[model samples]
Target: MIGRIMKIVSRQYTLLGENGEKHDAILMGKVRRQDVPAAGDLAEAEYVNGRWVIQKILPRRNRLIRPSCANIDQALIVMSVKDPDFSPALVDRISMLIMKADITPVLIITKCDLGIPDETEEMIREYENGPMKVIRTAKDEASDEVAAILEGKISVLTGQSGAGKSTLLNTLEPSFHLATQEISKALGRGKHTTRHNELHSVAGGLVADTPGFSSLDFSHVSASELGSCVPDFIPYLGKCRFNDCIHQNEPGCAVKEAVESGSVPQRRYRNYLGVLEIIQNRKEKYL
Candidate 1:
């Protein structure tokens, strides 16, 4: 029978059967010979030796390389207001990656108790005005803001480790004993305790506590497709004077002009240029 793979604890997996009975399953040889199963995978298994043995893994709609999850519907880009502080470029980079992967991006700002600085608030509004949904979250477990923001979505909670990704997940669902680390005082970077991408079942949805990566590199994508990855740049894409305009110093560039006109945020354009430069530098490598 086919079942949805829920929690993968070591070699054992908790499978939610079609009838809703949870079964503890292990990977059969046939399954292990193919692809390894993730938490969100739809798998075929059988009851053998008093335990379910997963035999096959179904195809995934989409997969994220870093988080190592398949069939994700959206991403929760968590950022903190203090400690390591919030970086809008990091948010923009992740948002661009989601856009390229055809997934929804939700901006979740945590550590609101430290006061939402003006720059952070403006950054949140800039993204909210774009294609992303922006919401605020606190360290408090009872805060309904993050819970309401996460309703009914297969969202991946991602950010720098010290940014409170695991803390927020624990707050969202207290049952998940996801280990969290404190920020390093000397380095000012998050000490990552999350080692793998594990999915936790939440009310009306599933949230994946993804392993954090310090840096995001989008140089693999082609330069021609880079402009479209920026959601705000979509409106002025085709309106450019030249079909191959990179929007840097090009005359009659709608995107740059919009930034000057306050239509698009200056930071977003700067990040775009930064990404464009990376793409251009890595252009020959990808080809």
Candidate 2:
């Protein structure tokens, strides 16, 4: 009668029932109007008239925007050093978004066998040295770094396509065998392989491999609220000269001073400023 929707495809969901029978279910009207029933959703369903129909969707602990998944424990952000390359700004923004949503963010740098780009290495050190945890993964290696990071967690994989998110998942659980794509030669990017967000069982955890993007819009986060998203800035937030410090060029600003004194990663501060500008120009968009 009740089950969790494991996967949704062609308007049909694969529901794992309490009785342990996985059935193909169609959504009823009331259930469809409530919210998108993402994978891992505890839902009410029934086999009526010889067809399964989802009847209800339970509340979610958290939801990711682009991927549109719910009840996430944390997120693993994959970035490559070569092929499609890496973007530190994108990494910082996504990491900040995770923190703002009260979800832990773990950084995974892939393609380590090919070696890391200078800027990519710098970003890795920045994350590892600061409040966030970082891990480096390589192809064809027996490194369980990603699995160790995701142990007992419902972690989502996000990055530019070809950043090796799927590859990392395959390494974690060889049986998953999710589709992966090669970088485009003409466009110098990766072709999309993951079509929709679906949960895959990993080593003692679940992972969502979603479509990659060139960049993510932070229009949902505000300028003032943006500083709080950077976990390292919390300690110096109230110590500023003015309570309304935006941490820019404000007089007696502790955040800016920390940036200058190497307390916070300079690149992170720069990324924060860039986000601040975007948030300022489009303040209402975020609010």
Candidate 3:
């Protein structure tokens, strides 16, 4: 029988069967050695000798490298606007990974009730007009619009802990009762509450609450490929004087001029530089 893996906890796979039955499964020898199944994988399981063992993993449409998951239609990059504060660096970093995997990235801004700072508002506006669609959520309100967009799609909600990923999931599907915690005052961040990747049925679709993107491993992305990942940079990319311009300090760089001319938001450019440095530094360590 074929089923979709809902979540795997401590090597125990819990899958949703064809008739909506939940079964606990484990990977068989060949499947375990060849392909490691992720949360969103459609797998073939066999009830041989009274054990539901996953025999094979189906091909994936797209795979998110961070918070590792597969076959995702869209990724809701949840970030808080006020409490834990918004980090454009992390947002842009995750966006690059999602785009590289060919998954639609949606910026879901949480915690608007605490109010938005002028600077953050400006940055949000940049993303509002960027490649990915931006959606803001208040602590207390209906998520019907967000829910409508999630309908019939395999979506994942990921961000910093206390960014309200679990809260938003509960709001969209009241029965989830996902545990949430307050932001730690000392650290100025959220508590890591969601421990594992689990896909729950929500808004007539499957939405997985990943264990945040705190350790968003972006080491695999190359600096040269970074420009193409940022959709906004496309128009000014090849126009640079240097054919290998990474858009920083290169003479006659079109992207730099665009930032100066107000074509690209300064905040995004700043964040872009930060991620670019990270990728370059990671490359340096290998060499």
Using lDDT as the measure, the top candidate is 3
Residue 242 in model 3: lDDT: 88
User: Model 2, 1-287: lDDT tens per residue?
Assistant: 77766678879888766665688889998778868778877778777899987888888888666676777888787888778777788888887888777788877888989987677677678878888777887887646766676676677777877788888878777776776774234445446667676777677666778763335677677667788888778788888898888998789999999998999988889998988888787865546
Return the TM-score for each candidate structure.
Answer: 0.87, 0.87, 0.87
For model 1, residues 110-220, the per-residue Cα lDDT tens digits are 898889879777777887787667787777654576677567667787787678888887787877777777423444444577766666777557778875334576756
- lDDT by residue (tens digit), candidate 3, 92-158: 8878777777777898999998889999998899888776788999986767879988898889887
Each model's lDDT comes to 0.78, 0.77, 0.83
The regions of model 3 sitting more than 4 angstroms off are 49-51, 182-190, 238-243
Candidate 2, lDDT over the whole model: 0.77
Over 4 Å off, model 1: 18-20, 182-190, 284-287
TM-score, predicted candidate 3 vs. hidden true structure: 0.87
